[model samples]
Each structure stands twice: as C-alpha cells, then as structure tokens.
Target chain A: MAPDQIVFWVFAPVSVGSAVAMLFQRNAIHAALFLIVNFFTLAVFYLVLGAPFLFAVQIIVYAGAIMVLFLFVIMLLGVDREESLVERLRGQRPLAIVLGLGLAAEIFVTARASLGLARGPANFDETVNVGGNAQALSHVLFRDYFLPFEVTSILLIVAAIAAMVLAQRRERTTVEAAGEAEV
Target chain B: MKTPISYFVVLSAVLFAIGSVGVLVRKNALVIFMSVELQLNAVNLALVAFSRLHGNLNGQVLAFFSMVVAAAEVVVGLAIIVNVYRRMHTANVDDASLLRW
Candidate 1:
C-alpha cells in the first residue's frame, strides 16, 4: 500500500477509537480529552484530503477554541461526576443501539454501491493551482460566497451576546437568592 | 494510486453513528453536546472528502462555515448548560424536565 493509504488506515482507527472512548467516559473532563484526540486525528485527515486551510481551521477552531470552551464548562460546573447509566425512559438505550446499527449498515451499503461509479469531473484536479489552498479558498469565500461569510460573522456576534446575557442572568439570580437567604 | 472516496465516506458514517449513540445514551448535557460536536465533525469530514473528489473548494468552504457555526453553537450551548446547572444543581438531562406534565 502507498504511504498515504497507510497513514489513512492508521489515523482512521485512532479517530474512531477516541470517539468511542469519549462516549463511554464517565468524567466529562476525560470525555473532552478524548474528543480533542478525535479532533486532532480529523485534522490530519483534512490535511490528507488536500484542504490545508481546513486543516488549519480544524486545529485552531476545533481542537483549540471549541475544546477549551468545553473544558471550561466541564470545570466550571464541576459536573465531572459519573452519570448513572440507568435509562430514565424505558428502552432508550436499546432503541438507540438498533438505530445506530441500521444507519451504519445503510451508509456502508450506499458507499459500496457507489464505488463503481466514475470519479468526479475530469477537468478537476487535486493539485494547488497557481495559488495555494488558502488563496483559492479565500478567492471563493470572499467573492462568490461573500453573503454567507458575512452572515456567519453576524451569527457569531449574536451567539456571543446571547452567551453573555445568559451568564449575567445566572449571576443575578444567584445574588438574589443569597440576599433572600440572608434576610 | 488514489484512495477511494468511499473509504472516507464510510469512516464518516461510522463516526456519525457513534456520535448519535452518544447523544442517545449519555445523560450529562455537556457530554451530549460533545457528541453533537462529533457529529458535526463527521459531516465536515464528508464535506472535505467530496471536495477532494470533485476537485473543487466549495465543500471545504462550507466546512469552514460549519466550523464557525459550531464555535458559536458551543459558546451559546455551554452558557445554557452552565445556566441550567446553576438553577438545577445537576447536569442530568432527565432532571431538567421542569416542563414534564
């Protein structure tokens, strides 16, 4: 097998394994760590897929910012205690397992069926053009996709404000409860 | 020889399924949120794979948008989780059923 295929084989298992580990981990912190591993492996996959810009963003945004946010909440709430695995709703676990398996089978069959089809358009090539991955991505993102890009920025701003508002409300309620208790 | 796109698609599918199972079985809202992130990552992988297959950058661009949305989602989601914890003193989803008739 070629080196690329070998590398893909190795990291594919690593990513999937860590995801499974995240699911079974009782402590929220440990689960977050496992997810970081999964994200890192996925970043490597992005690199192999020839999207260098996506690789960088996957590492920076996902492995760095998002994971830190998850860890912060896990620590702040101290909800790291083990969760009771017992299902509150009857048959939830069994139903989930059955559905997951069915989904997996469906995807596998579809993938196998499509294996014989021709690859994408012949004019398309994987190599970087005169510019690099970042340049090409920026060209498309800033020009053709400008509207969605701007909208994404707006969504982020709204989310930040919402977060601050929610946190402030929590603080206010806590202070009010403490004051009432003192009175 | 080029790696078959089907391999990447299959991997993405499996990861997504694992994430779905985590969402279903995990009780902690934080962990459930992480599972959702996993699912999102799976979708990003499929997007990138198809981008490579088609020799276009659109899929990668969409993946970038997905990541931005995910970051914003995490910020809002974690804040809501923290707020829930503050009010209920627990992260268990079942415990937060204040609207249950």
Candidate 2:
C-alpha cells in the first residue's frame, strides 16, 4: 500500500468513529467536541484528495468558525445534560426493531449489487489541466458562476439578518422588565 | 498501489448512513445537528473523490460551496436552537410532538 493509502485508511476511521461517538454522546458539549475531531479528520481527507483549497476551508471555516459557533451556543444555553438524557421511547422497541431490520436488509441488497463490480482506478496524477488552486477558483467564481456567487452572498446576508432578528426577539422578551424599570 | 477511490466512496457512504441514522434515531437536538454536519462532510468526501476521478475542479468547487452553506446553516440552526430552548425550556425533539404523528 502507498503512503497515501495508509493516510486515508487511518483518517477515514478516525472521522467515522468520532461521528458515531458524536451521535451517541449524551452531553451536548461532548458531542460537539467529537464533531470537531470529525471535521479535522475530514480536512485531512480533503488534503489527501488534492483539494488544498478545500482542505484550508474545511479547517478554517468548518472546524474553526462553525464549530466555535456551536460551542458558543452550547456555552450560552447551558444545556442540562440530565434532563436531555430522558428517553422518550418507552414503548417503541418494536418500531425500532422493525426500522433496524429494514435498514439491514437494504444494506445487504446494496452490498450484493456492489459486489464484483470493478473498482475504478484512482487518479494520482497531479499534473492534470484542471487547476484546483485558489486562482482557478477565483476565476470561476467571478466569471462563469458570477451570478450564483452574488446570489450566495445575498443569501448569506439574509441569513445573518434572520439570525439577528431571532436573537433580538429573545433578547427583547428576556430584558423587557429591566428595560421598563430603566425607562 | 494506493487505496482505491471506491474505498473512499464506500467510507463516505457509511459515514453518511450513520449520520442519517443519528438524525433519525437521536432525540437530542444537538446530536442531530452534528449528524447533519457529518452527512455534509460525507458529501464533501464524495465530491473530492469525483474530482480526483474526472480530473476536473468542479467537485472541489461544489465542496467549497457546501462548506460555506454548512457554515451558514450552523449559524442559522444554532440561533433557532437558542430560540427554541428559550421558548420551550427544552430541546427534546421527540417531545416536540405538538405537531403530532
């Protein structure tokens, strides 16, 4: 196996394992931490796939900005762990069993279909004409996809305003009494 | 020889499936949110793999878009969660059965 294969094998498990852990973690903070690890491993996977731009964005944007937002909300809200641990499915065992069984059957069928199919070869050649560097990305974003790019910016702006509106409403209700007294 | 592209694709599918299960089975809102992020990452992996296979930059570009969207989603989603928590005093999505089955 090549060194790249080794890296892929190692990091892929790390990503998937942490994601599973995040799913089962009762504590919101612990789940967030696992998600951070999962995002970092995914960044490594992007690096392995030769998308350096994606690797950087994965680390900076997803792991850095987004996860921090999640952590901030977790801290601000102070989620009560014990209260969240109460399972609501006291009598839903049969339903869960049926779902699980159906999922297993689907996986079995998928695996059977995929068996004996010739795996596509990996393209390790880096000298390809498709430039994935930042410069190429800028050109595409500004040229062919310019309209969509601008639309995305507007979408983001709208999202920010929506968030602020939502937060401000809560602040208004919570601080109403204090505001009335100060006025 | 290096790991085949199929391995990465299969790995991504597994992660995506696990994330889907988490989204479906888990009651904790935060876990469900993280699972959604996990599914997004799985798509990124698939995008990168396809980029490698086709010798094009489109998949990487889409992955970048996915990352940006994921960031925006987290921002909006967390804000919503905070709002929900304030009004309901709980994020137990299962008990959010006011809509009813």
Candidate 3:
C-alpha cells in the first residue's frame, strides 16, 4: 500500500471510534471532546481527498470555532447533569437495530458502486497542486458561484440576529418572585 | 496507489450512521445538536470525496457552503437550547418537549 492509503487506514478507525465514543458518553463535555477527535480525523480525510482548502477550513472552523462554541455552551449550562445512554422513548432500541441493519446494507452498496467509479489517484491533483487548491476554488467560488458566496453572508446575518433574539434571558428574580407570590 | 473513493464514501456512511445513532439515543439537547453537526460533517466528507472523483471543485465549494450553514445553524440551535434550558430548568428533551403557551 502507498503511504497515502496507509494514512487513510490509520485514521479511518480513529474517526469511527471517536464517533462511537461520542455516542455513548454520558457527560456532555466528554461527548464534545470525543467529537473534537472525530472532527480532526475528518480534517485528515479531507487532506487525503486532495482538498487542502477544505482541510484548513475543517481545522479552523469546525474544530476551532465550532468545538469552542459547543464547549462554551456546555460550560455555561453546567455539566453536573450527566445524562444516561438508555433510551427513554418506546421504540428507540428497535429503531437502532433497524438503523444498524440499514447502515450495513448502505455501506455494502456504496462500496461496490463507488469502487468501480473512482479508481486510483484523483484528477483534481493536477490543478490542485499547480494552481493551489484554495486559489482554484476561489476562482470558481467568485466567478461561477457568486450567488452562493453572497448568500453565505445573508444566512450568517440572519442567524446572528436570531441568536441574539433567542439569547435574551428574562430576569430570574421576577420569575422567582412570582413563584413565591403564587405560593 | 491512493485510497479508492469507495473507502472515503464508506467512511462517510459509517460516520453519518454513528451521528444518527447519537441523535436518536441521546436525550440531551446539546448532545443531539452535536450529533446533527456530526451528520453534517459526514456529508461534507462525502461531497469532497466525489469532488475529487469528478476532478471538479464544485463538491468542495458545496462543502464550504455546508460548513458556513452549519456554523450559522449551530449558533441559532445553541441559542434555542439555551432558551429551552432557561424556560424548563433542564436541557433534557423529555422534560423540555412541551410547546404550550
């Protein structure tokens, strides 16, 4: 096996393992940590796939910014409430079993189909190496995909305003006072 | 030789399934939110893989758009979770599920 394939084999298990660990972790903080592991492995996978621009974004945005946001929320909300893995719903167990079976079937079909389609080294390597992945992507992003690029800012602005609106906490003092008055 | 695209797609499928499991089994709203993020990342991986396969940058560009959308979604989703916790005294979705005014 080439070094590239070797790198992929090594990291694939780690990404899957961390996802599993995140699934079963009781503490929200610990689950977030496991997810960070999963994200880093995903970044590695992006590198392997020849998307260097994506690799950088995965590390900076997903791992750095997003994980920090998750951690901040966990800390702000407190972690004393360690949740259990047992399903509270009536059908979760059976649903999980069905999901697992479906997953296996999907994997089998995907592997067979994709194997025949995309063999060996990727063709993106030519422009990606010469022009640089980020530069090539930027050209396409600006010229061909200008609409999507512009839309990102609009979505971000809306999300920010929505978040601000939702985060405005009503005073607890009045709520507690009302409770006392009711009592 | 580089790893086949199938390997990456298969990996993406596995990750998406794991994320789905997290969303289904976990009751904490925060954990569920993280699981959704995982699912998004898994799809992003698949998109990148196909971009490489086609020798085009569109898939990667779409993945970039996906990441931006996920960031915005996380911001709004966490704010919603915070609102839920503030109102209900718990982030546990079971106790926090009512929409009654």
Top model by lDDT, which number? Answer: 1
How high is the lDDT of residue B83 in model 1? 88
What TM-score against the true chain A does chain A of each candidate get? 0.86, 0.74, 0.84
Q: Model 2 residue B3 lDDT? A: 58
When 2 and 3 are scored with DockQ, the better candidate is: 3
Compose the digit string of candidate 3's lDDT tens values, residues A58-153: 999999999999999989989558876466667986798579659856886968764764654445578554588888889889999999899899
State how far residue A67 of model 3 sits from its true place (Å): 0.8
Reference-based TM-score, model 3: 0.91
- TM-scores of the models, in the given order? 0.92, 0.83, 0.91
Could you give the TM-score of chain B for each candidate, in order? 0.98, 0.94, 0.95
Give per-residue CA lDDT, model 2, range A17-41, as digits (tens). Answer: 9987887787888888998998888
lDDT of 2 by residue, B16-92 (tens): 77777777777777778888998899889988877776666677778877777887788788888888888887877
lDDT of model 2 at position A126: 38
Q: What ordering of candidates by TM-score runs from best to worst?
A: 1, 3, 2
Candidate 1 lDDT over residue span B43-80, tens digit each: 99999888877778889999999999999999999998
**Model 1 chain A lDDT-worst window of ten:** A121-130
Listed models, DockQ each: 0.72, 0.49, 0.68
